[model samples]
Target: MLREALDEANNWIGKVPGVVMVGEGRAQDGSPTVDVWVTQPVSLPQKVKGVEVRVRNSGDIQAQ
Candidate 1:
């Protein structure tokens, strides 16, 4: 199910031109878990369709 969620997230990011997906994982030492972050323009309107996953230390997701 994680892959499905990630794939869905990637689809939304793909809509943006010149957008890149960056994924980060955690280590056995339990240091930190990094995730994919999409670099989009802040000026873009909310009219665009896509899912949003928040990168937080506590692991929270917000989809639209």
Candidate 2:
């Protein structure tokens, strides 16, 4: 499921600007979730196609 979610999120990389990386992670409740690390604040959809999205801004320029 994580792989599928990562794949779905990867599809938005090029299409959506400011996306730094996308990976599988856990939610606050320990449920599996998709993590999207972004460099800057960008308008994003709650879900990409049907996959839920979790956007985070770490302000880590080393990644940029």
Candidate 3:
């Protein structure tokens, strides 16, 4: 179930402007969770398409 949400976020929701990467990761509390990597600190909705969106930083993104 968690992995499915990760896939959906990668294949579908990743198209969102701020989304950087979507995959399985750990919650801040160190628990297993899904991750939605982003380049900025935007206020994302609590969930996307019913799956909770956990936004993490992608550090520095450069296209050069």
The best-first sequence of candidates by lDDT reads 2, 3, 1
Give the whole-model CA lDDT for all candidates, comma-separated.
0.41, 0.73, 0.71
* Candidate 1 residue lDDT tens string, 1-64: 4455556546664455434543444446743332444444322232222322434232333558
- Clashing residue pairs, candidate 3? none
* Candidate achieving the largest lDDT: 2
Error of 3 at 5 (Å): 0.8
Question: How much does candidate 3 score in TM-score?
Answer: 0.63
lDDT of 2 by residue, 1-64 (tens): 6677678778866357777778777777887777788888887767655556788895756734
- What is the per-residue lDDT of model 3 for residues 1-64, given as tens digits with 9 covering 90 to 100? 6767677667765787877777776666765566778887766566645556677899888788
The candidate 2 region of ten consecutive residues with least summed lDDT is 44-53
Residue 52 error, candidate 1, Å? 8.7
Q: Cα miss at 6, model 3 (Å)? A: 1.0
Provide TM-scores for the models: 0.34, 0.72, 0.63
User: How displaced is residue 41 in candidate 1, in Å?
Assistant: 5.1
The better-scoring model by TM-score among 1 and 2 is 2
* Candidate 3, residue 7: how far the Cα is off, in Å: 1.6
